[model samples]
Target: MKVWILIFVCMFSMPLLVAVLHFRMRKGQTLKIRQDYVKNARYFGRSFSALVEKALPEMKNGMIMLSRQEKVLETDGKQEFVQPEIEDLIIARNTIFCPQQEDLHFQKEIYSEKDALFVKENIRLRAVYSKKRLLFGNKIRLLRWADAEHAVAVYDECDLGERVSSGEQLVIGFENVFHSLYAPVIRLGQRPEEPDRFMEERDPRIFRMPVMNSYEYNRHYIDDDMVTEGGTVPYTIISRGDIKVIEDIILQGDIHSDGAVRIMENASVLGNIFAENDILLEKNATVLGNIFTQGNIIFEEGASAGQPDKIISVVARGTITFYGGNNIYGYVVSEGGGKILKSDREISGEYCFPGEPVHEEKITFRDLSEYENVDFQGFRGDIYVKEAIIPEGASVIPKSQFFECRSLEKVYLPESVSVIEDYAFADCHVLKVWESIEKLSLKSVGISAFENCYALEFVSLPDSLTVIGGAAFAECVSVNKLIFSDTSLLKKIGDHAFRGCRNLKEVYLPDSVEYVGVSAFRDCSSLEQISVSEKIKNQPGIAELEKNCPNARIRFREVNSVEKE
Candidate 1:
């Protein structure tokens, strides 16, 4: 009897222990990129710089020279592909030094530790790493890449060949061309105008209090693939299958897809594009906001992301392909490395200034045969539900899976469900979930998963919740109580998460929360108190939180500092 009881205990307790460990591991691991692309892109160059240092340790095998003459005599820079000792780089005082001067070709990599590095006019170099600063003269070109710790300046008509980056400031002169650039501040062409200055100067629109008349949010939940050829879409789109946007059009809202996304010629989107599969953009296509994906991203000829003044992000976890002349103003990163492809039209294997075109078969937009398009738009995405039940053992409840299902209240989730993806139950007014689950095992609630649910009164968060993405509960006016378990592993509350929640009264942050993103609890007029530990209050964006909630009293709870992973 004792043996049987011990076996039963081990079986039940082991599963529970494993579940706890899984959530703990998930909480500890940090993702490099997500929906908030523009905010997190500042670290792109520094991350690559670290990887470059590790890969080519010879670059840092340099020493500071006593004088400019000693540095000049160290390496005969006129020749190409000249092999030197491990300390191949030259470090001197503030002097104009070009390793490949006579023939204008420097094949070896250069690194400077304590001095500024400068290059002469019309020179071609392999790679350069500057510890202090890097400056370039007229019409210079780089074969591989260049980066600096302090600042980088390029004079007239320079061609920053592949990747030129600076963690601090990067300034470029007239008519310069490059494939990619990453910096906190990047200026171009004698321009004094700041990025987003135009946006700030625009006349503010008048806001009139809206009277509730409709329950639908004009945002479409298309069951089949939908094509956006030419027209105006003033609302959001949640697509289930592959979506194609051909021709020129301006979209005022975001586009979220479960499958691939193809943006054809001259199309411009004012919002974001979040895709599960690959994203393809044709020539002259523009996205004012972010473009992110788990799969590869391909750009066609003259295709641009972001603006000349405003900064945005174009990222892909898989390989990123740029078919010449494709430019991105801000962050352009690919975990699987970036490739620049010339057109198949030209047989010559030389790279050109304006870049060659992409050879692609342009296809017409196709609306699938079995298309079922459902569009809804409301004051707060008003679709009503009282109760619901999910199928047992279902690990994922995909976004817009229950599009037309109403008359649901409390949700019955399987213990295996770890993530509720973006817009999974969005606008489901009065939808109360998590009462029937025997074991609470949820980890992540994706972006806008529960937005605009005005009838929701309370939500009890379990300890397993780690991430609550952007605008998760925005405009939920009737949300009165939000309970977070004492042992919660919540680390991040994303941007505008609880924005415009008029009736929310109070919230207490667990010690596990490390970050409260921009405007996470903004516009909560009825919020009376926000209790958090001193460590949470000292976080980077926590101070800005108070400015958003003018009426809320932020009470810091006295507690021991929590150890972070």
Candidate 2:
């Protein structure tokens, strides 16, 4: 009975010892698993493993492998496997897949220095997908030869396996040791939009500057816009359109254009010109011809044109401005003043002449001065001022003949004046125009009479005016704000009449204007608002005006109530 009791005690103690041993074994296994997961998570966070994994499919002839312990890659087969000699790693990242032969794709590590490889010229290159194809030793830079050195790569010549169809398996090795495989290429049916892989695309960096030289043509002239890309020519005549002297465009004869004319450094035009656009002469530019543009004119310092006795006539639609150092030996007519530098020189129908001993008309200034006095009496025809000289007691009496005073500015019309003729004061920069003219005596202002005056900003129109011709104030750039009280006289506004008045901010039109010309305010960028009469609603010109100035505010109201009438 005592022997039986002892055996029972041994059996019970044996289970207790076994239980302790099993518990220790489970704890060791759990620690090992936890350590492995932690190590992998740290590596992934440190190296941006997820981003590399996404970019790995772009690599070609290369593979990245991730094992339980570390990460490795297999590059092109051949040579001493020099890991540091690799190039165009980004190209490999954009071309080849990390795993080409296995179902489980390896998590890619693009930042890994050892994950990229490139085979140079005169070396054996074993393709990733081919066993039968072997490239002979030839001097060629793999992947590095692509146009974009940073990201894109293209192999000059490469061969793959025959069985590598749309979907196929490719073997991958770690450090030249074969380990796994994956499928990468996907063959497809005929594609029409794909670019031919053989043809090279254009790179913007390869463009070279154009070389230009002057060429002479006696009777022949180049009418179209000529663009040069760095070549040399001799004495050429450019006419009609925009002429750009990028390089030295030397002309033995005149260079004329109906459009804009631009001259850069070391350029010289020895002839006269008639331009419709602005003329821009850059540094060291020289023009031997008279420049006439229906637009603005600008010249940089060190630019010279014409002479005092043989001066060039400058006609502009807006202002004719020049740098302080530029020598302009010609007559400049702006709606503003002369010697205008650093300031805006507006072009009015005004001209400048030297003082004469005796005046041709009844009004004369005994002593010639920049500002003189004028006398208007006993003159049957319209009185005229030869120069910019203003005479004392100058008046525009009834039945007077005044056609074109090219250099007239700030002339006060007498209260007795009536019926001003057409084209009278056509381009005057009369700053205080019509200051003395009475409402009843003033009847008409000729067509195109006050077109391009840079300084004639305000005008007090007479209520008695009955007839205003076309193009009354076509291209007045400096006339920022205008309020017309007389609406019964304005009938028509001429075509393209106000094309380039970039500074005209506001204009008030009355119902008395029955017709509006085409492109009247075509390029008036500063014209913020225009109020038209209610009578012009649903009209073609009004519709065109709205379309052209979509940014400007338009208002349509009864003619009588437009301006507190």
Candidate 3:
């Protein structure tokens, strides 16, 4: 029993001895760690102090001083300058630290890597890194600042040639070798310019405006015709009634008439002319700007519009006719028809005469099976057939050939067809199905070829197609899917090509497609998936499509790889 009691006492004392030894070792480790931390902190403080001392001299010298005179000393000459902290420099430059009253017409100009102009009331100027031109409209002060060795200069002024009538002060600032300085001030007032004789001498019957002036008049007739010789009109002239310019007239501003406008021989107009009724330009007439009319427009012999390189459009709701020796440098658009009578006339721009669509009750194509080839160059008959078949070996479909066939439900395209021109099947609201004759040899589908076909649900593009022109399938709201042929050679899809296709759910764009124009697939609200190559997916055209259909899932694949949906 004594041996057992000794053993118990030893066991309890052993635990107490072990606890004292553990506490002593832990205290020694804590003391060493504290000493190491203190040594490292002292070294870091010395290194940071050395860095601040090295940067302080540069910071002090970089401070910009705005002075009234051009020559200024860097230091105060007698005493040594004390360098301010980086935070102090930033606060001094920031408007928040030194608030100033807002200047009403403050204009600021700063020279960036690119030339940039800014106009603001109270703002800090930042350095520019690229070369670009920027214009701002307001009055502001220009601020130039320097940091380290980099220097920036800013100047504020109105655009040099801008006409300002109000008395405004212009301030110019720049950075010199030693200091930032402002140049001598210049105050400008509105100049007194004389009005044109025609504008000064107003007539009740004729609308007359000088350059930089505008006027309106009632029904006017220029019987003398020579009254507009050497006349200058910088602003618009509007008339409520018919206008007749007899002969040898010259005017600068645009002319708008509610009734018919007639310009006699040797008349020249520098600006656009519009008429609610017909417009007639007689022999030797020259127009520099566009001509638009609701009624017919006629250009007689020796008439010219626009320069050779510039485009001046001529548009008319009715027919447009051009006589001999006419040189038109712009486009001509007519809703009804267009006729060019003279061979000597030169038209540099396109002439579009989308002839009236056939509006007849019914159309039949019973003889289509017998014909090996069909040509519809100027056919004006209705194409609203209940059923139509283009037999094999049929070659071409001319522009506007089958436009506005509202009742057409089915169409069969022949394998041998090579060309389908613009607006071939436009406005075919009921056309729901298309059957091709085995293989298609078609090369091009022109602008607005199948636009507004509301009943079309799906389309399988042919392999031989190379071009799809602008707005080819626009407003095809019911088209749910578009399948590209495995061997498609398509290269271009023009602007607004698939716009307003609300029900389009899936589309497969082949790697052969190189260009997808602006606004393509815009407003495709029901689009769920699109498959495209990586190169095509990153293009701006795809970005535009994504913007319009935010819910569409885009699957990008490498060229010649299996497509993912």
Task: Output the number of the TM-score-best candidate.
Answer: 1
CA displacement after TM-score superposition, residue 271 of candidate 1 (Å):
2.0
Residue pairs of candidate 3 with colliding backbone atoms: 105-139, 106-139, 106-140, 107-139, 107-140, 113-130, 114-130, 114-131, 114-132, 211-234
How high is each candidate's TM-score?
Answer: 0.38, 0.30, 0.35
Per residue, candidate 3 scores C-alpha lDDT tens digits across 249-287 of 665557799999888887767667899999999986767
Model 3 residue runs over 4 Å out of place are 1-384, 561-565
Better of 2 and 3 by lDDT: 3
Error of 1 at 104 (Å): 11
Compare candidates 1 and 2 on TM-score and give the better one: 1
- Model 2: how far is 88 from its true place, Å? 61
Sorting all predicted structures by lDDT, with the top scorer first, yields 1, 3, 2
lDDT of the structure predicted as candidate 2: 0.42
lDDT (0-100) at residue 313 of candidate 1? 72
What is the per-residue lDDT of model 1 for residues 440-537, given as tens digits with 9 covering 90 to 100?
68898888887766565555676788999888878778777676766788999887788789888988888778788777777788888888878777
RMSD values, in order shown: 18.3, 35.3, 30.7
